[model samples]
Target chain A: MKTIEIKHLWKEYGDNIVLEDLNLSVKAGEFVTLVGTSGCGKTTFLKLLLGIETVTRGKILLDDEPLVDEPDATRGIVFQRYSSFPHLNVVENVMLGEEFESSPLFGRSFGKKRQAIRERAIKILKRVGLGDAIDKYPSELSGGMQQRLAIAQALIKNPSILLLDEPFGALDPGIRADMHELILDIWKETKLTIFMITHDLKEGFHLGTRLLVFDKRRHDPDQPNRYGATITYDIPVEKTDNETLDEITGSMSNKKQEATL
Target chain B: MKRLINQHPRRIGKILLGLIPFLLILGVYSFASNERLEINPNDKLMPAFSTMADSMHRMMFEPSKRSGEYLFWTDTSSSLKRLGLGVAISAFISLVVGIFLGIIPKIRAGVAPLITAVSLIPPLAILPILFIIFGLGEVSKVMLIVLGITPFLIRDTQLRVMELPEEQIIKAQTLGANSWQVITRVVLPQILPKLIDALRLSLGSAWLFLIAAEAISSTSGLGYRIFLVRRYLSMDVILPYVVWIAILAFAADYLLRRLSRSAFPWQITATREAK
Candidate 1:
């Protein structure tokens, strides 16, 4: 069964329609990257998938089960900013994901279970390259380290789907490259279905097994509100060699140029 | 000279600089009091510092002939009890109401304006009404403090909760936290420092209301004793009482600051940046 399936989704905020007639499906382990211009409803689509926003019309199914309107542990998300809880240290932040599952009071676990969770948190932090910073607050860490902590916080829950909303947008190039490698490594290891939204076309193509472009097909200057954005291109990243990736990039750039014109 | 003072001041120099205005005030008071005393040896309007100290010692240490109770201790305990109860009640109510108003938009829209309106109603103006309904007892005084500060605290806490990043709420929910869990674990912990801050800001008004209520009706309290001695022009006793009240307020403020600093170190950085 497909990990996620959306049918004829429409999200309208009064007259300002953000998304319309959107349909998508993803296999269990596909790393899908969504790329679009700013305000193209890319983030909104990801929010819908995470159940952060309600669909105006149509249905979303997770593992063939109808998804509810509230966010759940079945899906995990990393926002571009404010993802990590500043008040919690790195280990506590990572432990929070697991903590919420067993104990709702937050960090109230005790005895062997608590020790085991702590060990698990420490292990996950080490995996995310944050072992040395386990006791440090998020504010004390650099931007790249904070983002890594956020990923660890999300991934500790072991959600079947991981959603990323421009999670590397704030990082410097070197850090961004390192983050891309880390994300790829984690995706390969966990085989969790990943949906990431980004404005960086190269980064999107580099990290995704499939790339989707969201854009409005029609523009009525007098009534721009009449149309909403939808997925325009869905390309499978043929990862056999560099030439295939380059050819896909070349065609995508052509499409982007034509759309801009 | 300015640069030297700014950059290379010793600790003693900084202490002396802080004391300048206080020393100046004391000098002026002493000069005026001496002139009055020299003119009229029985003048009671401006008592000397030693006279005030003597009165403080008597009130604080000696037991009353009739009740055998130290009036100073009684008044201090009574005032503290009322103040503590009032602030605690207000903080609890504000937390509960503020979280609801902040999380549920519908409730916020419906009740926020009402809260604003209620907050605008001068708490002092209804002092007589509170006395009439609750009686001129500890209840009325505590209610006055609650009435004076709860609205402001609620508004402050609600604003803080609302100002929290939407991403945090969403992130909390995505981590399998239900609505109650989100409010308790995510919202409450984050807003606790803000609540302390709001309480600190409202302390001035809380003291004002408590004094007003106590002065009007209480048989025993700092304000009651001060007002009672005012008719005789007992400047010595009145001044000490006022100083005692100041000390209490300062102590409360300092303790709350310490609490927030230790309990929520993350919040301290945000507040420092804001400053």
Candidate 2:
């Protein structure tokens, strides 16, 4: 079964329809990247996958089962800004997801469970090259380091599908490149299914095995909320240079127009 | 030594020299006034000074009585101890409540009016009702102190939580943090400095509530001591308690400032540069 499947999904906020009749499927361990201009509903799709936003119509399935109301360890998410807990050091932030792994009901603190969670967290931090920073507070680290910590936090549980909503969008080009490579390496090593939303077209092609391009029609200058925006194309990212990738994207857009007509 | 001297050579030298005589003059003036200003034996001024002298003497000479002894007039030391306990407990409680309420928008929105109403109720108004329920015991006093102080903590913390750099929240969430993880890890840390500040502000309220506590019920607190002295037209004893309250409040505030500095070193640098 596909790791994630979306069928006729639609999302709306107030009178605005964000995603209308969206259908897509991500195969097991496939790297799926979503790229679009601002307010193209890439973020909304990621949020929907994470179960943060509700669908107006249709359904999202994880491993052929419908995604539940609350997010579990089966699906992990990473946001654009580094949301490493300032109060908690890197280790604690990473271990936070472990609580969800054991049970949905909170407040079961066991020694074995705690140790297991800690080990998993440390392992993830090491994988992300943040083992040394496990004890450091988020404020003590640089932006890149904090983002890495955030990645570790999402990676700790080894979820079947990882949802990233512009995790490297805020970093400088150099750091962003490094993060992109790190994520690519991690995805290769773990073979984890990924659904990353990004605005950078180059980054999207490099990272995503399949790229989902959102439509210009979905964006409104007056009311711009990406979580409630319509998405359009679900294009496979062919291994090619920047010029070739753009041509592919253009072809995909034309196909969408034909389908709509 | 040479490097240090060069860094602040002329400024330090001038300031040190200038302060010597100014300090001496101030001390001499204070001592001279104490000796020369003779009020009528029956006048309120003489008794006030006597009370001040007694408190100073007790603080200097009687260390054990500060904690061990309990008397109607002897409350400065006890008041100091109780105030310390109140602050510690209130701070702990405030941190727990502040973080919980601050993170949950629904809870904050739901309880906003109730918290506001409770906060607006004067500490004095609650004293009688608290006394009736809890009696003239430590329970009522401590309860009043918490009620007086926690609302400010909640409001201040909620504001801090709201003001948290949106960048951090968006970043963490993108990283796959659930709501609890975000609250404890990101939001709580950033909001801590402001919360500590709120707690420090609440300290002054704690002392005020403590006095109110003594005033309404207790036979042996600084407030009660002052009330007792006022009855006898003994302004001297009353003055000491007043001075004692000021000193205690100052000391509490100063200690909290130091604590805040150690806990939030960033804020210390922030304030030092601002000054």
Candidate 3:
């Protein structure tokens, strides 16, 4: 069964339409990477998947049921920046999800429950290679380490679906490579269905089981925001990466010219 | 350094440079006081340091014959109590109201403009109204302080809450945090240091409101004592009281700084990054 299903999903902000006529579905544990030009509504797509943004029309279903209107434990997200809270230390950041689940009112746990969360948090931190920096704050960590902490935070709740918005776009090339390896390792270990948005097409090809290209198929010369972006290309992964990358590049350039027209 | 902006004063240089203005003010005051005292021994406008010291000693150490209370200590306590209650209440309300205003868009849209309008109103213009409503008692004095600073604090707090990155809130929610849990867990810890910062900024205004309220109506406060001694033009008592108030404000500011620093070490780097 498909874990996620989007049927003619559209999003609009007043007169400005941001996404439209989108149809996609994902089987369980699929790594789907989305790429698009700026203002083409890739972040909006992530926000929609995250349940932070509402759909203007159409519907998104999770596991054959309608996705909840608000964000819940079933879906977790990591942003490029501010994925980890600056005020919380690494372990505390990881522990907060469970605490929210345990104690909804105070967002706190006492004695045994708190201890269990702490232990689980430390274990996840070790898994993410942040054991050495458990006591350190988000501000103290490097870009890669902070992203690792963020991933750990997302992972702690053991959500079935994880949304990543260019989680490595801000990192240096060297650090980005390390994050790629780390995320891949986690994906292999867990059955997490991830929808990651990336600026880098090569990274998208390398990481995702399916690559989604979001671009506005129709545009109005008079009103730039008349129509929103649709998933113009949803390519399943091939064994060879370079050929597919070149194919996407050729189509992207052709698509850009059409968008101008 | 060639440019003032590039100049970083060494520790000793900073201390000595800081002393220059104080030393200059002291030299000017001492000269003026000594000159006036020499010319007219009964000069109440510019009392000598020794005379101020004697008055402070009598007020601080000895019980008054009529009241059987150390006037300096009594005044200090009453004034501090009022200031503390007013500021505490203001901060408590600011936090509760500001968080709700900042996090929830519906509440913010409904009430933010009203608060802005309230903040814009001159607090001193309504001082007599507060006195009339609450009467010329301790309640009026405290209410005046609360009214004077709470609006500023609430607005500051709301602004700080808005300044927090949206991703953090989303992350909290995605992790299954309820609305209140998101506030208590994510918003509260981060906003507190900023509130402490806002409080530090509001201290001068709080003291001003307290003193004005106390001077106008109260019988036992630092402001009351300072104004009461003005009939005989008691410069000695007034100068010492002024200095004492300055010392208290400085100590309070220092204590707040230390409290935020020790309790929230993460805030330093976070704020630095924000800058």
Candidate 4:
């Protein structure tokens, strides 16, 4: 069964049509990236999978079950702005789901659940290169560290699918590149299904196994029926190492001028 | 630090100096003069002050007088105990009700207008009716306190909950947090500082209503003691008791503020900027 299936998904805001009839399917353990410019419905597509924004018409199914109104432990999401609970240490944030899931209603107190959650949280933190910072709060960590912590939190649940909405969009280019590699590394290690949205074409080219390009030209705020938010242009990206990825990044610099001309 | 203290000590000095003139006038009026300052017995402030002074003199230097009656009925320990219990019980009620009214949208929408209307009613005005029904009982006093303070508490808690970040909530939801988890882990902690502030403010309000309740109906309590002293036109006892009330209020307010600061240092900085 497809990990996530979206058929005729339409998202609108009063008169503004953000996404229209966007049909896409993410296979189990596949890494798909949606890349487009801002306001191109890339974020909306990710939100559809994560169950944040409701679909105006089309249906989304996970393993043949409808995606619920709110996200569940089965789908872990990493946000762009890495603000979990600052009061919670890195491990505590990661383990939050495990603790909650462990407790059946009217179960043992918060203290008992927390202890088990903390142990698993630490193991997951180590997986994301934050072994030492598990006990540190989000504020005490660097931007990159915080993002890494966010990733650890998303992964700790061991969700079937991971949804990332411009997870490193706010980071500097160098940090973004590092995060891109880190995500690829984690995906490879866990072999988990991922649906990532990004505006940067290079990052999309580097990480995406199946690339979907959204056409911004179709977006019209004034007209409701103008275009869907995402018009998928499927592009294939060959699996490559850090060096080929760097070459793709360099070539993209030349494409920028060509596109402008 | 010394310079800051000394430079602004003028306001402090003036306040302290003002006390000396006040005590001198009071002493002269009470002991030195056979003819007392003419007080229209009908006026509230002067009569209240006069009775307080007479009670103080009788308690301190004079023996075998009205002080014994006052002491027996309204001792410091009993008043403290009753006020403490009233505050704890009423504040707990207010906190739970306020949080529910503020955070839960349906409850908030349903109760907001009614609670606001109830809040606008003068608390003291209801005392006579409450006295008729409840008849000089503790329940009447506690209920008066709860009625007086709950709306303010709910309003403050609601505002605080509204002040919490939409982003944090969305983040929590995306993290697989159910509604209950979102409330206990995210919403409660986020609004806690404001809730504590509401709690403190309500406690002060409860005290105000408590005094009013006692003054109106009771034969004991700090307020009743002051009321009984007012009948004799003893300002001395009244002033000291007034001073005591002021001190207690200040100390209680300070203690609560300190507790808020220590409990949530994150709130202090964020709440200040939000204001």
Candidate 5:
């Protein structure tokens, strides 16, 4: 069975359709990256996969079952902002998911259970190279370190699907390169089914096994929100030659500029 | 010459600079008091510093002849107890109600405007109603303080919760947190420091309500004593009692500030964000 399958999915906010005619099916342990111009419903698609937003039509099946209406532990997410809990230290932040799962009422663990959670959290933090900063608050960590903490927070839950939205867009070039290596390493180690959205075309081709390029195939100037974006190009990134990759990406960017103008 | 924008005074300079206004006020008070006393030896509007100090000493240290209680301590204690109880109850109610109102759209839609309407109705305007309902006693006085500050605290707390980033709640849910768990784990901890701050802001109004209620009807309190001495123009006793009230209020506020600082160290630190 496919790990995730979407069929004829459409999302609309009243008359404004944000995504339309989307169809995809993916086996487990595949790295899928999405790239599109701004305001093209890419983030909205991530939100839909996250189950925070409801679909207007069609269905998403996760492992042969319809997707749940809300977010849950089976899917983990990392946003550009990280969304780290300011009050909690690094270790506490990472293991909070487990705390919520095990102790549903208080979202806290005590005694031996608490200790077990702590051990698990610390082990994961060390894996992410945050061993020395376990007790430090999120404010004290640098940008790169905080992103690592965010990754650890997601990884602690052992989610089947990891959704990342522009995870490295804010980082400097040096840090972004380091992040690429780290994410690739994690994908190999865990065999996670990752769906990440990025603005950069080169980064998409370099990281994703399958690169899905989103664009609007239809538009009405009279009714600006009449048509939403759809996947225009689905490239098997590894099999594509460098010249073809450059040509496709270049044409897409030109369209992007024209649309913006 | 140092530019004012970048200039920060050293600690000693800060202390010395802080004292200048207080010294000037003292000098002016003494000058005005001596001038009035010289002109009319019986004048009571501005009592001499020594005379006021002596009255304060007697009011605080010595037991009253009729009641056999040190009036200053008893007055201070009674007022503080009422203020403490009222504020504690208001804070608890504010926290629970505010959080509910903030997270749940239905509850907020139904109740927020009612709270706003209640807050706008002057608490003092309803003092007579409270006295009529609860009677002129400790209950009425305490109720006044509660009714006065709870609305503002509730509103402040609700706004703080609503102000929290939407991402945090979604993140919690993605980690398998239910609605109740989201409130307990994510919403509660983040709103606490702000609640303490709201309490600090509301304390001044709490004290105002307390003293007003006591002034209107009470046997023993700082407010009662001050109004009691007003008939004879007993400035010496009244001035000391006033100063004593100010000191007590300042102490309570200062303690809360310290508590908020040490208990939630993260609030005072820099923002927790990545580039």
Candidate 6:
């Protein structure tokens, strides 16, 4: 069964079309990674899925039900920057989802329910390797630690789908590797349907069960913005070995390769 | 030692450097007062420090002979009450209005121009209008303060809200926060420190309106006392009142700074790193 399905989706801003006639179906518990060059509509696709940007045409279905125009608890997102509230500490940040769920008006819960929420938040933080830094603020944490807190914040609500937009883009290589392992472990444990966008082809190939490449196949010299980018390459990596992946990459690049990526 | 001083001045040296300007002003004032006294022993202008001190003691400690009320304390309490009421009301109103204007594009488009136009009007020019409408009472004075500062506060808060990263708002919503919940939980907490900063900046203008309104008409206030003593050339009372006003303003600013540091420690850390 598909967890998310997009049919004939089109996104445009004024005369500029960013995504055109795109269709995607993501099954439950699939780790999907998208790779593209800058301004190739990769981030726009994520925004459309997160409901931050509305589609110009067509519909998106979540668990066979039409998704609403606004964001909901079923979908969680982590951005490259500003992934966590700087004012809240690690524990408070992780607990924020449950707090909002319990008391939508006050953004807080009280009594025994609040204690349970805190304990859950702490357990999640521990899983994310942030138990010692629960009392620290985002500004006090290193870049890697902050990303971990953000992941905990997103995962605490047990969202069915997690969207990450270049979440490890700012971390060092060592930290990025650690984050990759952490994210993979989480995906394995929770069986979440995750959609991640990355500029690094190796990272995209290494993590995801399915890989999607976005690029504008048809280009006109006179009217550059006439057509939007579509998914030019969709490679299933779950069953393909490293040698087979190279053979697939060679054939895919020959079919519709763009100069940028 | 010289190299060390050039690289970074010691704490004691920095303190002495800061005090130099104050000491210079004091010395120049004392010299001017002595010169004036030599010409006229009964001179009311630039009264001696001792003379000013005596007047302060009388106004602050002793009750009025006719009314049996400590004028200084009564004036302070009344002025503080008006100032506090005006600031608190305007802050609450501006917060609600500013957030709405910032988050909702339609409301922002409709009301932003009106607020900008109102803010452009010099608050002092409306002093007579406020007095005539609200009458020569505490209401008028407090209203004047609110009118003077609310627009600026609203604009500041709106800008702060707009400057927030779009990702944060989206993240909040995806985390199951409805519109109101996103505002209260995410937007409100982020902008509170900024609001305190806006209030701190508005206090200067708030004091200006308060004194101007009080000078026009008021039964009891620090501004009223200052203007009352001005006609008699009571330099002793006037100078002391000016110094007292300065002290009060400093205390208020200090208290606000301390409050922001304690209430929002994360903001402080962020600012420190930014610096």
In terms of lDDT, the best-performing candidate is 3
lDDT of 1 at B132: 91
Better of 2 and 6 by TM-score: 6
Clashes of 6: 0
Clashing pairs in 3: none
Stretches off by above 4 angstroms in model 6 are A238-261, B1-6
Worst 10 residues of 4 chain A by lDDT: A216-225
Candidate 4 residues lying further than 4 Å off, grouped into runs, are A106-116, A199-201, A216-227, A239-261, B1-83, B101-113, B170-176, B262-275
Please provide, for model 1 over A102-168, each residue's C-alpha lDDT reduced to its tens digit, 9 standing for 90 to 100: 8765535778887899999999889989989998878778889989998998888888889999999
Note the Cα lDDT for every prediction shown: 0.87, 0.70, 0.90, 0.71, 0.89, 0.88
Reference-based lDDT, residue A165, model 4 = 78
* Recovery fraction of native interface contacts for candidate 1: 0.59
Q: How would you encode candidate 2's per-residue C-alpha lDDT over A66-96 as one tens digit per residue?
A: 8875555567767665355555566877776
- Which structure among the candidates has the greatest TM-score? 5
DockQ for model 2 equals 0.20
Residue B74 C-alpha lDDT in model 5: 93
Task: For each candidate, report its DockQ versus the true two-chain complex.
Answer: 0.54, 0.20, 0.82, 0.27, 0.69, 0.76
Listed in order, each prediction's TM-score against the native is 0.91, 0.75, 0.95, 0.77, 0.96, 0.93
Poorest lDDT segment (10 consecutive residues) of candidate 3 chain B: B266-275
Q: Candidate 1 residues B50-136, lDDT tens each?
A: 999999899999998888999999999999999999999999999999999998899999999999999999999999999899998
lDDT of 2 at B113: 79
Q: Please state the error at residue B221 of candidate 4 in Å.
A: 2.5
lDDT of 5 by residue, A112-210 (tens): 998999999999999888999999988888888888988999888889999998999999989999999999999999999999999988889889689
Instruction: Score chain B of each candidate by TM-score.
Output: 0.94, 0.75, 0.95, 0.73, 0.96, 0.95
Residue-level lDDT of model 6, residues A1-261, one tens digit each, is 248989999999999989999999899999999987678799999988887788999889988888877788888898998889888888999888999989967989999999999999999999999999999988889999988988999998888899999999999999999999999999999999999998877788889799888877787546667889889778886654677557545644653443423
- Per-residue C-alpha lDDT of model 3 across residues A24-128, encoded as one tens digit per residue: 989999999999887889999988888878899999999889888888888888888898988888999999999988986799999999999999999999999
